[model samples]
Target: MTVSTDPGEAATAAPPVNGNAPGRGHRGPVWLALTLALGLLLGIGVGLVIPQFLKPGDTSPEAGFLRDMSTHHAQAVEMSMIAHSASTTPEIISLSSDIALTQHAQIGYMQAWLRDWNLSPTSSQEPMAWMPDAEGSIVNGLMPGMATPEQMTALRAMTGKPLDVEFLTLMRQHHLGGIHMAQEILKLSDDKNVTWLAGTMVTAQQGEINLIDMLLKKLQTA
Candidate 1:
């Protein structure tokens, strides 16, 4: 499914909610949340000891991917939080919550790995520089599939079906970009742990993209 890169229509004026939808609640699976929490704790614990065996340098692709993807994941969490709070649709609420919690945990793993390598979370090199011939990919310092400030502000002001549609649309684009980076890492990194995480991202985000497409079609047609 193709979406406008800018999502101009999604950024239009819409009725706003006070904070969260009054009667709406997230119906996402409880077990999933617990599993993610457990995984995060385990990841951090393992990260502390892993560096004694092998650690990537500051300019290594593993380091760059971890740092850049952490930043990328942060925006996804932010957008999901906005959608989770305001959207009244059960599917949107559940999906947004899942995305937020999942990516937030993944961020923990990425940052932990960075610390294990004794590398700074922020990088001096350009984003995506680790990827070969990746010039022009970063537009105005924003990574691929990231929303602009104006688009995010417009999303904050929207409510109801409009908000749901926009959130799903934006997230779908975001996932595609994320999946690309993850796939690239899978190809570039020989590190077993890093490639494993990248593989998981590619698989999970692709599945979510399929769901997002279904949700978008349902929302748009309704």
Candidate 2:
């Protein structure tokens, strides 16, 4: 096995198992704007709005969650970019592209939340404080769905079919990790947009996992 050299690795916070949000919540008309903005952020496809609203504070769980999740999603987007270029299968390439596009937009959404809150993009606290049990090998300091440095290095070295398989496998793990985080946020969060997006993440990533599994099986047979 190759070695992993991620600083977040030893810290044991991992982005959030699901994905993380970047900032806390805000009060007043900010809620309306945030709700509308997030809808636009998620776009028409998964931009289903909820009726409830979130509370505001510099360190609110909702804001931190959004900020952290957005950062997590950014890494996923980066990984997807790699897979899009290197995958041998058109299906895999398409799937990777979709992930990149969706998560990149969502990252923008979370960043907007931070700006609305007048909060910094990063937290002074250790990673995954919002998630207490997130102290495991894969559960690094900040990015829950993140792959290790060695995994990234291996992927960079691969070109064709091997690249396809490895990419699918690692991405599957990443999505699964993300799904775990999303499920947690869904249970704990009450903010309309945040909860809705977290739940949607579960649904979308699960379907992708199924598709990825099927792809992997077929590739293995081939």
Candidate 3:
């Protein structure tokens, strides 16, 4: 058995035996102009007119997405932090670091939105309430792509190739679920900032997913 030299290993190592686991677009300046125009219109509607027409309450889709995605991003940051500290491979460590930092920033962005909206970071409703029929394959409450406690424990215990593979697997799934949530929001929301962020997430996460899948195959051969 290969022992892990990961400095963070001890912190993640506890408990055992559980189960497991865990868009692109183009358009030139003309398209960009149209999209931006649409976004401005939506923003104005949300800021000025929409409040009078239909205010988003605590149970609104935006609130639910903010709350749930914050939680979801938290786990990714945690796992990626572990991988960043534990993995022997430089590529894996770098990838994990990028994942951790990017998601960490996103979490902050969402939380700031919550505060700016005068909403609580958490909600009384369930996690996936915003997208009731979105996707059924979720863990714990209803957050998709989250690793169970046991899987996390296992990840903490693993090292080397196993650790890299496991991280890729979990992170890939996590990204997929996040993309799903983002896409769902794009469909349900007309708020310019909200939709723009969601659209950005879909694009970024999909690129990462492709990179992770490629790395997974490369690591499998090593």
Candidate 4:
């Protein structure tokens, strides 16, 4: 899929400073505003393309997976973006940036898939009915890996090492939840594309979980 990101979200790393200019104070409003704008722009772009992916089929497995996974990944992106600004640990900052980039691209891809499948990005059925086994993981009737509104609000409020630690903990739990959903998709989805996407998720998130585990240990030690 031709998945392009918002140019504004591109990273601009700072090289070692000359130690002359006092470091600019990290402005929360600036970072948060930029993050929100970038997310909204990308979301708009995705919505525009999604309708093209739909076909005549009412609700295909591909459509369902795309719809649900897009929602799930949006949380990951949001959480990670929060960590990108507020996290103190270098490792966590790097990890969150990676997640922000990766999930944004994946969201774009799934949005494209939904457009190709001829389905609305939104769904009517109870979430996770595509795989009955998923019933066990529901929280407040939503599918697994979704952060509660309160949790999301609290994540936005955290900063420094506390933010890094909490982001790692919450995101690890989120990935585990997603792993279960992806496994179900692997088994229940007949569409080759959907099954392949599920397997990709399993492999990617498993690797990320291991990395997050190591970062968690590093943060504890530091």
Best by TM-score: 1
- Judging by lDDT, tell me the better candidate of 1 and 3: 1
Q: List runs of model 1 lying over 4 Å from the truth.
A: 1-53
lDDT of 1 by residue, 1-222 (tens): 665566555444332355434443353457678889999999998897676556788888999999899999999999999999999999999999999999999999999988877789998899998988778678777887888889899999999999999999899989988998898888898999899899999999999999999999998799
* Whole-model lDDT per candidate: 0.88, 0.76, 0.84, 0.79
Cα lDDT tens digits, model 4, 1-222, are: 564475543322333345332454457569889999999999999898774553425465556667788888889999999998887677888989998898888888888777766567888866776666666877796668677888889889988777888899889988988888788777766666677778888998999999989888987998
For residues 35-151, what per-residue lDDT tens digits would candidate 2 score against the true structure?
Answer: 998888777544333311234455666676776677778778878889898766799899999999988887887788677666788888555556557666234453665787888
TM-score of each: 0.76, 0.71, 0.74, 0.71
Task: Arrange candidates by lDDT, descending.
Answer: 1, 3, 4, 2
Instruction: Kindly report which residue stretches of model 4 are placed more than 4 angstroms away from their true locations once superposed.
Output: 1-56
How close to the true structure is residue 177 of candidate 1, measured as C-alpha lDDT?
Answer: 85
Report the Cα lDDT for residue 90, model 3: 87
Candidate 2 TM-score, C-alpha based: 0.71
Worst 10 residues of 4 by lDDT: 8-17
Model 3 worst lDDT window (10 residues): 15-24
lDDT of 4: 0.79
